[model samples]
Target chain A: MSLKKTRFKYLGESLIEGNIKITAILAIIAVFLIFFFILRESLPIFFNGEVQQEITFGKFFQGIQWQPVSDHPRFSLWPIIMGSLKVTMIALVFAVPVAIGAALYSSEFAGRRLKEFIKPVVELLAGIPSVVLGFFALIIMASFLKNIFGWTYRLNAVNAGIALGFAIIPAIYSLAEDALNAVPKSFREAALGLGATPWQTAVKVVLPAALPGVSAAVLFGMGRAVGETMVVLMAAGNAPLFSLNPLESTRTMTATIAAELGEVVFGSGHYHALFFIGLTLFTVTFVINLISWALFDGLMSKLYGAKK
Target chain B: MNSKGHLRKIKDRIKIGLTGSAVLLILAILAVILGTVIIGGYKSISWEFLTQPPKEGMTKGGIFPAIFGMVFSLLMMLIAVVPVGVATAVYLHEYARPDFILTKLIRGAVNNLAGVPSIVFGLFGLGFFIQFIGGSLDRSLGQSGLFGQPCILWASLTLALMNLPMIIVATEEALRAVPQAERAGALALGATKWQTIQNVVLPQAIPGILTGVVLVVSRGAGEVAPIMFTGAAYYLPYLPKLPTDQFMTLGYHIFVMTTQSPDIDATMPIAMGATLVLLALTFSLNIIAIIIRSRTRSQLRKGR
Candidate 1:
């Protein structure tokens, strides 16, 4: 009856427990295997003389050009890195306000019926596949945007980034809404008891109190934008440009790997190079995820006092 | 009550208006996207489009091959992920102490797994599954081509890995909803821990587990990156006859059609149709999962 942790006293307990324990640990094993294998595959680019003779670590960060196939192939990552940064910046700029505003409305202003309606709508948005969003951006949004903006290129960072915004809004909105909701009732009551309006209570009191979680939402949104592949692949004109222009065609790290990996020669420099890009992406997203998780955990502990 | 009060009230109303508009703007975006897709998708969708394979450089015919491959890979992925995901959830809920180090690590890994990019999973599939494990199998079995290549099995495994976290989280929430009284009653009847879990806990969790299964299938069906290099192909003359055979999938079909198709004008409709099919698939499955989850939640509430 006291179930802190079940102590099953039976003859075959060890067998059942042991079997379940192995499966239980598979998540950790999967994570380790992913990191290890990605790192393993990417190592050739650094130490393997064959790959190094073609591209060096110094040149990888320094070179402006990113042509992987040419008479003189260069493996510099600056342009694509710039592209990744540009697309991510545009996505964050577009998604953060819309997501935060939506979160605030759902958590603060909406009544029960409206909350229910908003919830499903967001879920439906979340449910849409990335490939479908990419298609929308490519076939529909791209042209629509062209008519408005009149860009030289049909597909550019803005088209992909805004589409990417839709892809990530669900995540940021949910987390931010949860954070805003988690602000204790006492905070709202106290603010209201001081003659503050509902808007003031929400914006000034609840939002500031939930800052950690809200920032975590922003960070998670950033991570999603950074690692998002298919949307950027299909929508972002896959030209690696060094310019900071949002209207230019951009190629991201994730998109580069996806678009190029199909044609790469196994065990070749290009192959390892793709793996290297994968490695960088993995590390960056992993770090971002961990930071956001920590921030979210901090918010949980702060608000709920370790119970949640 | 005073002059400054009027200014504050106006500012409050302004803030409320802005936030409310934000909500509408998001919903409007959602409507536009869905509206456009539905309008365009309806035109491309016909009976043959659902039942037949593409013909004449993919400008005509249906997407039956893509649907078949999507279902095939999803089934494989479910077979691989469910047991492990369910078992992990059980372990987290029933077996381990909440503060145990191993439990903390498992939970951390589960959360982190959710955040790993879809494309990273693709890389791991190539690096670990195809090259490493498959290469090892090929070497050990003295066969070169059989195991060391992109195929449905590897793709499913990659997808299984990608989806393990989601299933585990859902199952854990479901397991959590099974009230303590049920366990207490089972234990009071002299049932052992394993017996209580098997007889009492699992029965109530089935709906929740089914919800997780539906969700996994929906996600696995739409996931294109991990499968792109592992098994999903641009085109296949025939359906995949073996686990090792590459196959067409709806998501990858749309990707290739939009990005790399030779006849963009001709194939745009097919691509739109494929997008609609995938959208219909994931959306319906999501709605089903949502329904199941809500029902389970209500059941849990009532039982409590």
Candidate 2:
């Protein structure tokens, strides 16, 4: 009787364990499904003869227009790609210096109480919704920025990029702070003991040591800025113009997808074109994530000396 | 040597000044964003605006339907996501071997899922959920379009998927905080592993799990892109009574008012009102989660 009961108990345990394992595996399956379905929908454009004729590689890459809904559709992605790059560049220029500065201060200089206060205030910025930020940009910041810079367009890449910079600062600040904090305390002491002043030690000793993780943080922020949708959709004047000027109106890949996806007919060239943009976005972000992950792991091992 | 020391002091003062300004700039930005919303929207908000549906093409009316829809969608998302996320976290922390291939793959998936853009989730929801699953359901049930269209169910599920990594990461931290000695004690008393986990581990982990749920709720409530194509409507006369129904949401409502409203000047106030509410909801939820998380950390330290 005892042996039979023990067998039953063991079976129940294994059953429960198996169930948990399967549930965990579902996450992996979900990721695969997202990629698979996105790819499946996009594949039709390449394989279907009609879609291929309409949205050929030359038209998509070389043509200088994106008038997809017109009588004669041109699906060149050059303008949209330029728009995205311009906004991302502006956002990085605005965000990286301030974020790194704040991170350095919080990690290296702030008093205990001040650090505690600054940390949550910075995090609070992250909790604000992108839509809310977009609304602010649309109604207020665009006008505010236009007045300051005397821009021709109210909603241009600069306005959108500044808002995007606000959205991105928290991610960069938090990660960069973590990287700064992860440097061994002994390193700071060594620099100070060698007659280096606080600023000299921070810039010459600590910054170099933390550069890997900080770079990773910047890469993650770049990925975030590239993928953000609502802010650009609402703030960037959704004009698919091929321009490098930050003050000019332009559209991003995310904004284009958000604005057009709602109206496009399924299985149309426009639909496939949007998916193609998504695929490109997914690939870019995936590469960024992969590189950041490698750098992060290297930094961790460097700091913690490898985990068992 | 004295002159060099004086130069170092000047450099330190300049660096300090710069970093201080950086901190001040962030604080000022936060203040301006919040202040602008509050100053612009506070007057438009009234009890009537909170309770009544929009009238006059969203120019003059309350966003009751939007608020109701957002809450309902959050409830639906909470129901769908919490169980799956906790189970994943439990398996990772408690059941699976640390170095197993499966474990690493799941971890990678979770990390990658978090990196996917919110709009991509919107596309996946449209393709997979509304078109694929819902369409299949409609056909199998012999119903024409009951589930094949964008609705609250698909939107919530999509949001839940977007938030799953966050929940899993948070819950895993919580689960790892549980001491192994307690688990061993429960098992040494002849309790089965599952039983020990159920009775002893879960109780301790509930606060931490709640924190994760709160964070997910905060995130889901604020996200607009994933729902824009999935279920959120520009205008809905009535609140969503069924999962299959389309609904207006605060974030989407704000988006519509700012972008698509006919009377831009008239709609600005209402949009600001809605923005204020959405900000309040997300910020309060985030604060509650942060407080709970800090408390949990303190308790863990005390236990140690």
Candidate 3:
């Protein structure tokens, strides 16, 4: 009887373990599946004759037009790519300095109680939905910005960029603060003991030590600005124009995909074109994340002396 | 030497002022955003508005269906995600060898998955979940368009997938907090490894698991892009009656109303109203999660 019970228990345990393993493997499969399905759907744009006839590589890269639903459709990616770049650049301009400054203040200046209060409040900003931020930008910030700057376009790249900056700030601040805090206390003590002021120690010693992590934070922020959909979709005015003016309306790859994918017929060239846009976004963000990870690993080793 | 020292002191003061202002500016921005949403939306909320479906081209009436749909889909998402996430966490924390290549691969995948744009997740859901899996199911079952289109099930699954990383990370943190002595004691009592986890570790990790659930709920409630292509409808008169039926959600409702409404001026109030509800829901969930997490941390510190 004891032997039979023990055998049953072993069988049950093994079954449970197997089930858990399979469930865990699902996460890995999910990542592979996202890449696979996106790549598979986007392949027709490159190889399929009908899709290629509609949107060739030369026209896609060289053509200035982006009217994918026009009578003679043109699937140029330049204007859209430029638009994404413009907004992302503007977002970085607004977010990075502010984020780094706030992070430095919180880590090197604020008291313990103040740090606790400020960190959560800043994190609360992150919890706000992108759509909500987009709405605020559309209705409030656009007009407010127009009144302040007297820009030609009400809903322009600057409006979307500033709102997008709000979304990116928390990410950069949290990561940069973590990196700053991770610098050993001994380093700070040594700098101060060697007759450096608090400010000097922070800038000359700790900041340099945390440079890789801070740069990684900025890159992560850039990745977010590039991929953000609703803010640009609502506030960037959805104009696929190739202009460097921050006050002019523009479109992003993410905005283009969100706006066009809902209406495009399945299996059409236009559909494939949107998927192609998704693939571009996927690739860009993937590369950004990879670089950020490399920087993060470097920072880890610097702080810990070396890794295992 | 005195003049040089004075100049350095002045520059240091200026630097401190700049950084302090930056922190204040961020806080002020958060306050302004929340204030505008509240002031514009508070007057629009009514008993009838909360209980009825949208009317007259979505410019009038309540968001009951949207709220109902949001709740239903989130519940379904919780059911699907919690188990898979906890299992993955358990496998990583307790079962997998620390130096195993597969473990590292899985960790890398999870980190990358977190970075994928939410809109890309929408595309993945539309292509893989709705078209591929749902279409295959319909074909195999001899059903016409039964599961091959956007619906609650597909949306829930897509959200669960998008939220898997957050859940896995949170659960793993919680699992790591379980003391090694407890596991050892369970093992010494003739418990198998799986038994030790099930009876000894998980019981202590329940609060942590709840924290993960709360975080996922907060995030899932606010995400609009992932569901936009999967199952969210512009207007659904009746609540979803089946898993396959399209549903209205608060986040998507705000998106459509703000972007697609025929009368933009008329729809503003309704949009603000929806935004207010979404903000309240998400904020409450975050607060609850924060409280639970802090409590867990305090308990762990006490135990230590």
Candidate 4:
């Protein structure tokens, strides 16, 4: 009987060991496969270093002309980079104020019932797929902008940026709310006991205390906007023009990658360049996320004074 | 006294006016989009439209193929995602210690995966999955027609992989939320950790797991770019049949109809209708999840 029990235990151990192996294998598969494919496509560019003679690296870096596939392809990344930065900046400008205001209203000012109603609606906005938002922007918002501002290009960066702002508003709101709610009730009570008004207590005390968390939330929002593709792809007309005017058509690295990657010849230099673009994108967002994660962890530890 | 009172009243009025306008602006934006989608799509939706195939122009047609594609691809995607995702979550939550370097590395990788743009995934899928994996599989399988093409299976696989990290994160959160006291109690009653997890913890985490599954499905269904490169044809005549079969999906259908098809007017209404259906399906899943979550919360309150 003891022998049989020991065998049964051995059998159970083996099964768990097998399961663990499988899980490890799956993780390895995902990580390696992603690295291999991205690197594989990106290899052609490195190998064909001599074929890169069409333009000097300096011209590629500093030139204002941004056509890549044309006969005399000027690879100045400044305009699109500037375009992406400008749009993201505009989005942040619109989003930060509204999100902070909403977060304050939800956490501090709103009644319980109103808070419950408002929170879910805001989250639902976050869940609305970017594709749908892009579609709405292209069809309705772009037309509205054209009619109102009489813009030359109906589909431009401003409309896309506005749509993106709406997409990101909820992320900022939710994260900021998380930060705001983490402020101890005792702190609020202490402020109130000092005969401070609710607004004064909220603005002066809680907001300062929650600054780190608020910063984390803003960083996360920036990451979302930076990595966002569909809205930018569909709405930002894919013209590789070196223009700062939000009214004119421009192409972002992400939008270009999406629009052309599928059709690019496999093992070609252009394909690797697309991968290089992907690498740039991945690096930018990854850095943003790491910073945000560190900030959030630090703030949490400082607030709670270590894990239980 | 008169000046102070007048200034106070004016300040209050201005504050109220600004706040009210901001609130009204948000509501109006949401209302306009929702109202437009519903109103535009509602006129085109009908039993015939749902059942029939696309007609001469996309406007006067149906979205039957697209609907079929969506359903088939989603089913395959769920099949691909659930096992891998659940396993990954189990490993992360149950097996891997929090302070382990490998665990931390994996956590960062998963978070990075989520942050990577969807377009990058599309590019990756196109280069590797379609050109390499699908092409190889097609050659090895040596099937004809739609099977010859890298079709539904490939698309589904790519999407499933895309959603895997989210599911793992959601499931891990749910598992983490299961009270440690309950787990300890079960262990004290002579239950093994695995047994306790299986019998006690999993039962409690079922609703959360369902929520995660629902989220994966909703996100996977809406995906367009990955499928575009992976296997989605511009116009697949018939619905995909076997594992190798090529197909159309609602997300692709809407894109093609709106952008690619020459017959714009005919396609627009049908595209809107298809969009509405996809929206309805996703919205319903969310509503159901919300209901389930509230029910679970109430149950927890009662238990406490």
Candidate 5:
């Protein structure tokens, strides 16, 4: 009797549904597949005799460089990890305020025509591919920046970070704009009725209400910047240096995997090492994406739940 | 009280001005990037540049091979991604037994998949496609190295996986726009669940799914890192004619010319031209997608 209630009226319908169910799971499968395959290659470092001969867990911490090539190879991940952090920090510091501000202006102040124009402009910026941005940063921005302020190196974290900042601004702006726009129309009306000006309404009422989403937007941008490869590969002078100076040439985790994985022998220590870097990059971004999605979606339900 | 009110008003003015200036600065950056490429690359984008292959160490000639290769790979990517993406959307929307828990899990996976650093994907492609799966197939079939190598097929499949989330999200949005009442109406008229979806829901979702496809193509065309070791060649003397052949892509071409070129000065102009072409291709596709999406969204609102 229970089976009868769930039965399909047509015979092939259940079959089709089953097929679709199998297909749908491929997305989840693909995600796991990526982790599994990368892990499969990366595990050799910890277990393989040949890889362990040149590399050890302690060497990664003790050594301060990522010189994977030489008579003596060192796989200290400190330099690249720090390099990733420095470049990402500079990029976020440069991008977040401007993106949030533009979002605020668009949501609170701009007229319909200005608002329309601004959205498409940001989309156009988004559509300009990362490689093109990398090209600009390399040939145009590098020299142009050099002429403005004389620097020891033409390509450094500052140059790469700014270029990377350009790549992420659109993403942050879009998310922030959506967050700002999500506040109920009545909230603004109520704020204005209480004698608050438009600026005060935006800053005090709407912004606090949208805070979760706005920060989520910033988090999303941070994730994208951390994972981005070609921009830093082209713009940052690929020097794996352990320094806090934003003016120093740097290499990032993503860039390291991209640049080294190409030339490394197929089944050697270097190849396994590159996969290890890939695993860390994957884990960093997966955690960020998970947290951001929670924040981004939680705000929507909260806003709408409050409306009810 | 009057002076304090004045001070508050002044503070408000300053804050608003700051936000507006932020907008201006972003616009200025975009303008500068576009302006530099256009002004610098204009002389290099002639008919000969578009139709001929690179000559004399890529200082002269056009980007025909890169164009052909990119289109070929994208076509294969479209074939691989669309059905899986559409099925994922349909299963979430129509089936899955009202389990929000399962739905949320799928979405979380999809979103995380999108955010995975692309270089890791390049590594995954190399390890999974070129060595593990491809090697297994070759060994089983008694072949030497036909399948166990970097080729256009692997690169396109890798891109399809990278882009699956975007397609699923877009298709779901389109599915959401179709009113529940319409589905009920179809059911009330003796239509089965499968029949109702096939006859009513899917037809309306085609535009949205197309928007996703176009967006993915535009995106995949510009991506370089995922294809670097998977199948993208630095310089291919011949165009890739089969799934097994390596291909040259515009983004990789720009990357190689910028970094690996022995003669940077001579290669810069050619790279600039390729950048403009890629920019134009992606921008026009983006505009088309925007137009289609807005039109569909308006129709959905009007129907509601």
Candidate 6:
């Protein structure tokens, strides 16, 4: 009976193996569709050169303006790129230090009960809807920042950047804490045995070992900041004119896509322009996410290897 | 020499002090945000708000229509998402070989899908569900889909599609975490592979699956972007009595009140009230997840 059952198992396994190829094909098609759809809309803009007028890739890149819908259209991406960079950089400045500090405290310093309390609270930040966060930024955070800084624009990049920082802080902290906790107890013990203090061991030894993991966490948070639409849409004072000053009105590529795409004429040049913006956004984020996952995979090996 | 020792002492003190203060800062931020929302939300929520119909341009009006819409739509979303999600997860975990190129591809695709921006999902939903499927349903169910477009059913289906990648990933991780020993033991006892999976693995993994379901449900409930583009009505006067009916949802109501409505002040209160309700709804799902986890842990302890 057991021998016959083993034969049946092999038969089932072979049957399952036959279906796996189709599942893989289906999964690949889903991914391809995303690229195909984004590219389909975006490709026409480049092919026609209607917006750029030069038809040359160099000129498209070198252009200094970006009025996609205008008859004599300008397609300079500098300002929105600058706007996205400025907000993302400002957000990273606030998010990284706070998130790292919070992770260290949670993993190494806190009491068990306090850690439990803190963990869920941080997770709750992740659960908060981006729309609600954006609304809060628009109605409350923007006004508060305006009063505090006495900014020219009530809604500016700084307010949005700060709000995005807050939104991303929890995700960074959680991922970083997971990294820190994966460091071997024996490593810590050996450091202490060598007369190093807890602080010395954590900063000098544990932190270095956890760099790849921490970097992955930071990168993921940065991607979240960049891709986020609502917070920036509400708070970033959606003027297309790009400026370096955080206090001045500026709009990100995402904010531009969201605010204007709905109104754009479908299958028109303007629509293609929106898709090009999305493609740029998607490529940037896709690269960031790839780096993040690669780092995570790489770091997990180090953490697990050290344990063995 | 004495100065060096003093500086070292100061530095040590600073390290400890900074760590302690940072933890306190985190706790403080959590308390402040949660406290402010609950306090403000309390003042806004009333019996009327819970029981009666929402009145246009009135802050004190109820959210019955939105609440009903939320419940019915969520139920539809879960029904649509769970079956396909679980099937995919089961295939990925239990059936697929690690070396298969297809499995590797699926894994990569799932990762990418999770990171795709929510608004992109909104765009896809608008193009696919609302335009394609919605147009079909509109023609078939004539009067139901008649005058306007983007009914409740389309909205729910759109949200379900949005939740798919997330649910599959969560469920796969949960299934992967189930112990190998139990499965081997069941098979050694001469149980068929399907029977072993059904009788031994699934029951053990219920809590983990529940955790995945909770995450998907909470995320689905909070999603506003896709629903906005796909189907949600700005001012649904009556509750959505059927899937084909037009409706209002709490998320959309908040957006309308804040952005579109004439009575901005009146909407602020409603937005706050609606936010509280949305938060509470998600929190309860989380609580159910926690209960499942604890129950499983206790069962394990008893068995041991």
TM-score of chain A of 3: 0.96
Global lDDT scores for all candidate models:
0.89, 0.91, 0.90, 0.75, 0.90, 0.75
Q: What is the lDDT of residue B207 in candidate 2?
A: 92
Tens-digit lDDT string for candidate 6 (B254-304): 666766667777677777777778777776776666566556656666766
Could you give the candidate ranking by TM-score, starting with the highest?
A: 2, 3, 1, 5, 4, 6
Q: Model 5: chain B TM-score vs. truth?
A: 0.96
Q: Please give the lDDT score at residue B271 for candidate 2.
A: 87
Candidate 6 ranges with C-alpha deviation above 4 Å:
A1-27, A48-76, B1-10, B51-53, B57-60, B131-154, B241-246, B294-304
lDDT, residue A187, candidate 6: 83
Q: What is candidate 5's lDDT per residue for B1-304, written digit by digit as tens? A: 9999999989998999999998899889888988888888888899999889989888888888899899999999999999999999999988975557777678777888889888888889999999988999999999977789989999999999998999999999889888898899999998888889999999988999999998999999999999999899988888888999999988999898888989999998999999989988998899998899879877877876
Candidate number with greatest TM-score: 2
| Model 3 TM-score, 2 decimals | 0.97
Query: What value does the lDDT take at residue A164 in candidate 4?
Result: 82
Q: For model 5 chain A, where is the 10-residue window of minimal lDDT? A: A1-10
Candidate 3: C-alpha RMSD to true structure equals 1.6
In terms of lDDT, the poorest run of 10 residues in model 4 chain A is: A51-60
Q: Write the per-residue lDDT of candidate 5 for residues A158-226, one digit (tens) a residue.
A: 999999999999999999999899999999999999999889999999999999999999999999999
lDDT of 2 at B210: 93
C-alpha root-mean-square deviation, each candidate? 2.8, 1.5, 1.6, 3.1, 2.5, 3.8
Worst 10 residues of 1 chain A by lDDT: A2-11
Q: Give one digit per residue, the lDDT tens place, for model 4 in B248-267.
A: 88777776676567876667
DockQ class, candidate 4? acceptable
Error of 5 at A165 (Å): 0.9
For candidate 3, chain B by itself scores a TM value of: 0.96
